[model samples]
Target: MTHPRPPRSVLSRLRSQLVVSVQADDGSPLRDSRIIAALARAAEVGGAAGLRVRSAGDVRAVRAVSALPLIGLTKTWRTDTEVYITPTPGEARELAELGCELVAFDATRRPRPHPVAEMVAAIQGSGALALADVSTLAEAEAAMADGADVVSTALSGYTPNSPRQEEPDFELMRALTAAGIPFFAEGRLRTPAEAARALDLGAHAVVVGSAITRPDDITRWFAAALRDAAERTVSPVTEAL
Candidate 1:
């Protein structure tokens, strides 16, 4: 059966803008939807292409504030497994209700046992598109088989075979791009330099977090820099004396 192409907003269709993931954690975004909304608006005003939000409340808040379409993901976990992002059709369905234009999920091969194909159908069924948050070529290939509308290199360094190294995994991106899959480069992208590199490597877009959104991480980065600078050895003996 043919599914309607998922609704794409003007902002979502653009490829050059930044997609900042507002970490909708329980501690911050969860506790304060206002902050999430404000940031979403700021991001929108700041020329964000889209927002990758975790919770439904955060999604609603952002949607109400800005016209920026959302990529929704629910943190569905079982028995110590840290499977954030929709792991089941049920979770995807729930996210769609919250105005998620494109629902994001972990499309890895770790036996979610949720019938990946069924999840895709459910996403289409719920009137939302699907984005596979994958790591390697294997996972990306599998996600296509399961009908993922888009594939992302979000977990490159976090998964086992997906090396935990820097760089945008250009080899995998090239492979996916060769296969006609749109690539979104994510994971440990801490600088604008890396963002440029990902685009050069043919990524359709890039999602940056912590480095842009999470102020706590920024605070720590500056603090650590200061500490490092303070600890530097004194190398001035013949200056003005």
Candidate 2:
């Protein structure tokens, strides 16, 4: 069955804009829906064009506070499959029903509980656009062929098939661009410069997460850098000797 493409107005609003992912991992102190709502508000104040939120509670909280378009998903860890992002059709429908303009799901080639087309239909049937999070160009193409409205580079570096690196996957972005696939540049985008670079590489838009929302992750990144610097430093006495 054919699904309607995402509205042009929604896509136009996101073009060349920053979409912040406001989510806190399980066991994180900031995992509360209230905190997520606050962060979403802060993102809007900071000029985020859209939000990528996780879980129904957090999405509801964010919706209560901000009018920015939302890209929503659920991370469910199952012993059966590695496909965690909005793993089930029920989850995708729930995210769309909760007012997400777009529902994101793992569209990687790994074994999944449901087919990519089923997930796409679920989202579109629920009145939302389907945004497939993929790790490779091949996966992106497959998802589009399966009726996904758009793809995001959010699974890069997370999948074993993709390059695991400290930097954003510019290679994948370039590949997607060359393939003429419109996509959101996400995952490991840590700075404004990197975000801008993704757009220069032909990304539909940029999605930044840890650098803006996850203070714990941001602190760890800084702490690790400082530790590395300290380890590289030699004592003054050693230098004198």
Candidate 3:
């Protein structure tokens, strides 16, 4: 069976647009749902076409505040598996029930409790599209084959088979495009330039997280860059002396 497309409204909203993923890590002060809603509203004001949010509470909050398409997902760590991004069909169903236009789930080769097809069915049955968060080209192929409406490069750096890079996985994006697979560019997309470049590379859309919503992560990025620059300058001056 062919993968079912998202609602035309959702697809039209996201085409060549930015989907800001407003996720705060476990210990972040911004982990609260209120802060996530505020970030979603800010992204809306900043012209984000959609929101990719974690957890049902965050989804509800964001939905309450913004009218944009929402892609919901859950990150649950379990002892049995490394496939944590919306691992189960139940989780996918819950996110869809929370008003998610699409639900993202791990579509990697890792051992998963619920088969990819089952999860996709659950999302579809709930009236939401299934977005496969894939790590490799093969995974992307499998996800589409298993009826994922769309695939995303969200798992690139997280999976062992995928390249570990500080930059966005444009190589994976290109590969997906060459294979004629529809996909969204995500993971390590830290700048407007990179996001734009992803679209130029034929991404259906781009999803940016941490770089936009997580203030702590953004602060660290700037701090690390400045520290590296300072060190480089100091080393050169010391050598000259």
TM-scores for candidates 1 onward, in order: 0.86, 0.95, 0.93
Please list the residue runs of candidate 2 whose C-alpha ends up more than 4 Å from where it truly belongs after superposition: 1-6, 235-241
* Backbone clash count for every predicted candidate, in the order shown: 0, 0, 0
RMSD in Å for all candidates: 3.5, 2.7, 3.3
lDDT string, candidate 1, 1-241, tens digits? 3345455553358476678888745566335778878877778788888888877777887888877768888775687454556877888887876778788888876656476788888887887888888888888888888787778898777777787665567677778877877778777778999887787777888888778788877788899988897688545773445
| Candidate achieving the largest TM-score | 2
Evaluate model 1: give its TM-score: 0.86
The CA lDDT at 211 in model 2 is 98
12-65 per-residue lDDT for model 2 (tens digits)? 899999999999999999999999999999999999999999999999999999
What lDDT score goes with residue 87 in model 1? 77
lDDT-better candidate, 1 vs 3: 3
For all candidates in order, the CA lDDT equals 0.77, 0.94, 0.91
Better of 2 and 3 by lDDT: 2
Estimate candidate 3's alpha-carbon lDDT, on a 0 to 1 scale: 0.91
Cα error of candidate 1 at position 78, Å: 2.1
Candidate order (lDDT): 2, 3, 1
lDDT of 2: 0.94
